[model samples]
Target chain A: MSDVVIAGVGMHPWGKWGRNFVEYGVAAARAALADAGIAWRDVQLVSGADTMRNGYPGYVSGATFAQALGWTGARVASSYAACASGATALEVARAEILAGRCEVALVVGADTTPKGFLAPNAGDRPDDPDWLRFRLLGATNPTYFALYARRRMALYGATETDFAMVRAKNGRHGLENPNARYRKAFSVDEVLASAMVADPLRLLEICATSDGGAAVVLTSAEWAAKRGTEKPVAVRAISTVTPAFPQTVIEMPNFSTDSGVAVPDAVTPFKSAIAAAAYEEAGIGPEDLSLAEVYDLSSALELDWYEDIGLCKAGEAEQLLHDGDTAIGGRIPVNPSGGLACFGEAVPAQALAQVCEVAWQLRGQAGARQVEGAAVGITANQGLFGHGSAVLLSV
Target chain B: MADGATRERVPAVEGWFSIGDAPALIGNRCTSCGTVFFPKASNFCRNPDCNGEVFADAELSRTGTVWSYTDAQYQPPPPYIPRGDPYQPFAIAAVELEAEQMVVLGQVADGFGIADLHVGSRVELVVETLYSDDERDYLVYRWKPLS
Candidate 1:
């Protein structure tokens, strides 16, 4: 597939702003258009990441954003894959540009989240696994996080301090990020002192829901050249792969894993498969990565990503943390935007926000939290059910 | 006629499990490829390579090893009814069944907490009351650590 240049990227600062989601999306869209030096009317396609919390307009986010930016009669598309919504929308726009269906496409995602643990929609739908887990098992999101954290403790000998180190590192990284929700740099002591929501995982260790928005503009390389764009960040690959059959890991909202007795286990586990697909498509290995933005729903999850994305082997992620390899100035810095640890989670907006941060870093525009000499950057995230997303970007 | 009167024991979600002396989770095995599904897959087999449309009721193993465990320190939101007035927290376990080779999640037996559980610890299935209404007692499967 041909590369599509990221002409511009923008975001509304993530916070608990209790306004309508459309407002944030429009603000982000306008900012992205301005950054691209392209008029809204010049865009040929509008792709939006849908937010479930918001009402009708959120469901039709593509048309909603296009209308908010003033109806330009542009073709529009909306995508929803839970937290991977942003990347799914970006993929749609990239495919449109790559297929020669459009020269320029605008992608946007925004969310107005409710406080506390995200719950299932109001209904007694017993068939829905998302609802069944809550009704029968009372398995909230943190339950799964804690399970993974404890598994790491049991299998890899990871300590609470190691998880705290992840929180502290991201806390420090987000201190200089204006777009981050929680900017205060937390100490390991402070994270350890926080209330335990689940065993081995604290309140500070897990991400909260937040309101935020992110937008990006993609154009054909030829279009970018005509606009006098220099050294634009181009998307090398986007992977929206699903898990192989008989997936053994107990993901969120599922009562049980697929039985591995009948069939051989997948060669790569689901999370590892997500980034492996991207790396294969980009024709680059983990060694080529200058930085990464991974979905750290919990502190320990970030460590898992280090291994999943092949930054290190399983059980060696804690050593990577202790060596400061994942810190901003260290080798293969992960989550330089402070990750979800500092950003909370804006669901649909999050994946695109990762892209926005990578774009800024590649262009040397990230003010203080910039990863120096960033070239090849990757974003990895997975949503509920089987939606896996990863994007590889380079300059 | 009184609050203490015998109440009908019911599965929290019908058809997923059974209530008896040897309470077992009722899963279905694909007649063609031998793939098993919990909460039963009556519609179709999920295996990508096999298109087995028929399944038979298979009783899952009563005992397994704990894959992982955790406790809910706070009360969960609705759809989950609290068992006590002040809301006592409960421990949960994901147990790996040897026969099916899949990990299933459930609440640990009423008294067990993170203190009493560890990964790979042996556990057995037991049916217990999850919550009770005026007329019905909702029974759910829980895991009890084998001493």
Candidate 2:
């Protein structure tokens, strides 16, 4: 495949803006265009990550963003892969550019969440697994987080204090990130003292839903070369994988696991398989990573991602944190952009926001949060409803 | 001989569990390969190695150890109907069936709290009324401490 490069990236700071998603998307799109020094009309394709939470317009995000950008008559595509929406959107733009179908593509994902735990869209569709989970088990998103948090504590000896450490580290970084929603630094005491959202996971250990937007401009490396764009970070690989059969772990939207009797049972866990696919595609192991941005929907999940991403051996993530290996200046910094703890999930926007952070760090543009001499970076996120996506970028 | 007519006990989700004294979860087992599934997979076995397309109805283990548990302090949004009035928090548990070698999620039986359970505590499945309306009592499976 030909090299596809990110020309620019932009985001509307994550928070409860109470504004329409269209406004957030448009603002980010404009910022990306300006950063790339390219005109909106110059784009040949517009790809958007659809947000299902907000009504009708959110469903047709491509047309919504295209019309907002003055209808340049660009080829538009909208993708929805739950939380992986943004990374999947990036995949769409990359495919178009690599196919030589478009010289320039703009990808955007944005959302404005209402206050409180996210619920299934108002409906009585028992056929939908998401609705079924809530109606049947009352398994809210945090409920699943609690399950994993408790499991990690039981299996790995991870303490509530270890979970608190992750929050403190991410919260400290969030203060340096201008676009972070929660800029206040969190201490271990504060995190532990916060009322328990679920047993084993305090309120501060879990991520909240909030409004945000992220956008990226993609073009062929040749196009960037012609435009004199210097040191552009290029997409080396994008892995969007599904669970292998006999998926052992209990993921969202499933009440029970596939029985192990039929097959020999997978030696590889599902989440590890997600990152492994990316490494294989990029032809680089975890050792090559200068930094990584992983989905930290909850603090415990971040440690799971550490092992899943091969940052350490299985069940060794807590020790990695205690050793400060994942800190900003540590061996391989993870979530330098503050992750979901600092930037509450915008679902559609969060994955690409991860990429925007990687891009900025790779280009040495990330100010106080910059990883010294950062080069190769990767971002991983798992979306509900069977979407596992990871993207590898290098300058 | 009657207390103001009669109300039917309904399965909240049909075909998931048994209705009698030897109550067990109803699941499907691949006859050829012996792979078992809960919530009864009406389709093919999920195992990639299994070519077995035929499934037989099987009764899952009635007792299992608690794999993990949590409490919903906040009222879960709708489709999950609350009993009434001031919302009460409820404990939920994930139990690992030894025979099936899989974990199943269910609400804790009425009157059980997080304090009553531990990671390896043995529990048995029982059908209980989840919520009731004027005409019917909606029944679903709950995990109770093995007495």
Candidate 3:
């Protein structure tokens, strides 16, 4: 199969802009087209990441965005995989190009999140697990993050100070990224002093919900060479794997976990399997990654990704941070784009935004927050239900 | 059924726990594989290895150890009911039941905060009124740390 290269990447700065998602997505799409030096009409296919918060158009975002982009009559597709929705869009576009259905594809994701916690759509449907989670136990999203954070502390001797360090490091990187939402630097003490939103996870340690958009232009490696680009960053692999049966971990929107008795137990957790699948498809290991952009929904969760992504051994993520291996100029910089801590979260846009950062870093386009000599990058994120996505990119 | 005149108490989501003094969580244990599931798996065993379609109702352990905990400082959006005058923060806990060998989440009992609990602390399930209306009192499970 031919390699799919990212010819261009673009994003509308992540923050609460109170703008319609269509406008943000369109703006991003135009920027990507201009960057790729391709006309909108020349694109053979378009894919959009779905946003549940938005009404009718969100469900069919590919066509919605296509109509706004002047109806080029290109093949269109839309996907909804919660947090992995953007990657799902990328998956669709990559498949289209690889299948020879299109020579060039445009992928886009955007969202304007509501203030505070995200809730299920209005209704009294008890059958809806998302609704039952909130109505029955009041188990909001943050509660889940806190549960994981606290569990890490208990099992691994991770401390609150360690979580604070993640916020501080990301805060520093955020100041340099103009597209980031919270650009101000925060001290460890400041992070600790911030009001506690969930036990063991202060408000500073959590990512906020925000509005943002990201887009990418993708083409076959041959086409990129034909376009005369000396070197185009290529997506080596995209892994979208579901959890194994008898899921032991208590994930979101669930009151309980699958029983573990019948099965001996999974050697690799779901998150680890997510990244491992990507590495396997890319024929690369974690040691080969020059940098990583992980889903830092909470500071403590970032540490978890370290182990999941194979940057470190299990129960050793805190040590990796302490050794500064995850810093911008460290052995393997993680989330040098400042991560979701600084970007907050724009849902569907976030996965693409992570890839956008890697695309820029591998191309040496990330200005102040650039990881020196960056060549290979990986992005890891898990969605609300069972969607887990990872994309490996290399120059 | 505490009192004949007491307001009708309803399980918050129905089929979770029954109304009684020694209330235990209602769960399902795969008859063929012996895997237990909370919130009751009705159809089949979730284990991928075992394709057991037979499940029997099982009562989970009433007491467990705290696996982890948190406090929700902000009012979670609907459909979580906020009962206070202007909504108050509440503590939540993830308890690990030894018998079932699974962790379950529940709100910490009233009067207890995050500071009052820690991992490995013993906690027992207790039915408490989550919210009440003119018709009935909505009851849900809470985890109470043993003194």
Q: Could you list the iRMS of every candidate?
A: 0.7, 1.3, 1.2
Docking class of 1: high
* lDDT, candidate 2, A291-334, per-residue tens: 99999999999999999999999799999999999999999999
Best by lDDT: 1
Better of 2 and 3 by lDDT: 3
Poorest lDDT segment (10 consecutive residues) of candidate 2 chain A:
A256-265
Regions of model 1 farther than 4 Å from truth = B1-4
True contacts kept of 2: 0.63
Number of clashes recorded per candidate? 0, 0, 0
Which model is ahead, 1 or 2, in terms of lDDT? 1
Which portions of model 3 show Cα errors greater than 4 Å? B1-5
lDDT-better candidate, 1 vs 3: 1
Q: What's the ranking of the predictions by TM-score, best on top?
A: 1, 3, 2
lDDT of 3 by residue, A303-384 (tens): 9999999999989998899999899989999899999999999998999999999999998989999999998999999999
What digit string (tens of lDDT, one per residue) describes model 1 on residues B29-129?
99999999997998789999988999999999999999999999988887888888898889999999998999999999988888989999999999999
* lDDT of each candidate versus the true structure: 0.93, 0.89, 0.90
Give the chain B TM-score for each candidate: 0.96, 0.94, 0.93
